[model samples]
Target: MVFDVVCIGHLAKDRIVRGSEEYEAPGGACYYGSFVLRALGLRVAVVTRLAREDLPLFEELDSIGVSLFPVQVPETSGIENIHPDPDSDRRICRPRGFAGGFRAEDLPPGIEARLFYLGPIMPGEVPLDFLRHVASLGPVALDVQGILRRLRDGELVIAPREDQGEYLKLATYLKADDVEAKALSGVSSLEDAAPLIAAQGPREVVLTHREGVLVLADGEFHRFPFKPRSLAGRTGRGDTCFSAYLGRRLLGDPPREAARFAAALTTLKLERPGPFRGSLEEVTRLLASP
Candidate 1:
């Protein structure tokens, strides 16, 4: 079957710390984003690399009907996230494991997809040439976090790339949070950066900030406020937003409507811990709520 989206990245074994409580769980943008896409009733496939022992952690994706194409490696990549406050944005990021890198040849041939999502956890996870090759296959949706994140003395740090313009040109839809936007575009304000980021190349640039989501499309900016009652499930906020937005666009929703739907769905997702488990009806109801 032709998939609606094909996500490429590493499936991570993440150790998350919220205040004094800590637990290990499955993570990585591809892990969360693919699940949300499937839940939204889209045909999704994930191409990932992980250790043999970590392969079983993907059972949830199998149960959800997402096609998994994995590359066996020595160890599963991982991250250690320490959230100082459960409700605050500040956190310490450290690399737990490096799963090794992937090449374009690793992708299964003839796998058709409407959108190719790049969800690498760190720089070089997916190389620039590989990213460009995938863009030739279909519209590409990029999560800038992966490209900008680098290990500095074992700590995850946001590193800007000099080839930002070239990378942006390969993405049809680009998703970046406030921090990532500043790091990549060198603009401190989303208000000032969204347009500049769009001008760099993505047909639409979606920037998520504390206030809401800002989308630049067709020379106009549309803002949507997140109405989630809590930030309980904040870890995958950007992943959820980008996946849902791209799914909506593929299903023929206008750019503005897609952004709104994505924001509403993400706000709801932020209220829970895992990938969006809610149905389309639930998200619709939330979007309908005043």
Candidate 2:
């Protein structure tokens, strides 16, 4: 079967903070990307490994008819973030045991994924070589938080990588936030950052800030700015963005259309607490308005 979006990597139990308030939400590219795509009425699949303790999450996905190519590991991984304000900004602290070390053998079979998104929660878990192999199977989308970070002074922070020169060469659709772009590409303008990012290898690159998302690829550039909605929760905004974008793109939507739809999907998700909470109706309304 053909999959609209196949998300790789691990899941996390996230401690979400908006201002002084805190809550836990389920995280992992698998959940976020697949959930939003399914919500959009598309075929979605997950190729991942989590602890057996997390089996219930799989059962939950299965009941909804979301296809799963599951692998079991001994433990589940976790992460914590402190959002300093309601402005939707955050600082993250990762626990040592987060769940994404995907062996190629562990990946599920008999499917061709059209769009592959890899959200690596831990640095060095999904090797660049492994990603290149995966991309050969499809167009790859990535959130580089995993590789762009390092353990510094015992805190999880974005630091320069000694080995990024090659991994950047393998990515197709790349995404990063303000801080992440600063760390990963060393440029301030997301568009200016795109050429540098593409110089590394991706055919398309985007930089997202609290204000909006920017896309540059195939010799074209575009930006989508949101009107800053008051959110119920925005724990998985970027994940939702990447997921929805891939979903639309796989459906043959143009890049600008795909990116705008993704931005709308994420804006709606910002009003919810978890992955899979936003719907197509919600995403459409946001996408249609001026």
Steric overlap count per candidate: 0, 0
- Top candidate, metric TM-score: 1
lDDT of 2 by residue, 209-283 (tens): 777788887979878865546665556667777777767777888889988887777777676677756557766
lDDT of 1 by residue, 114-190 (tens): 88998888667877888888988989999888788877897898878888778889999999999999987788999
TM-scores, one per candidate: 0.97, 0.91
Give the alpha-carbon lDDT of every model: 0.86, 0.73
> Stretches of candidate 1 above 4 Å error?
none
Count of backbone collisions in candidate 1: 0
- What is candidate 2's TM-score against the reference? 0.91
RMSDs, each prediction?
A: 1.2, 2.1
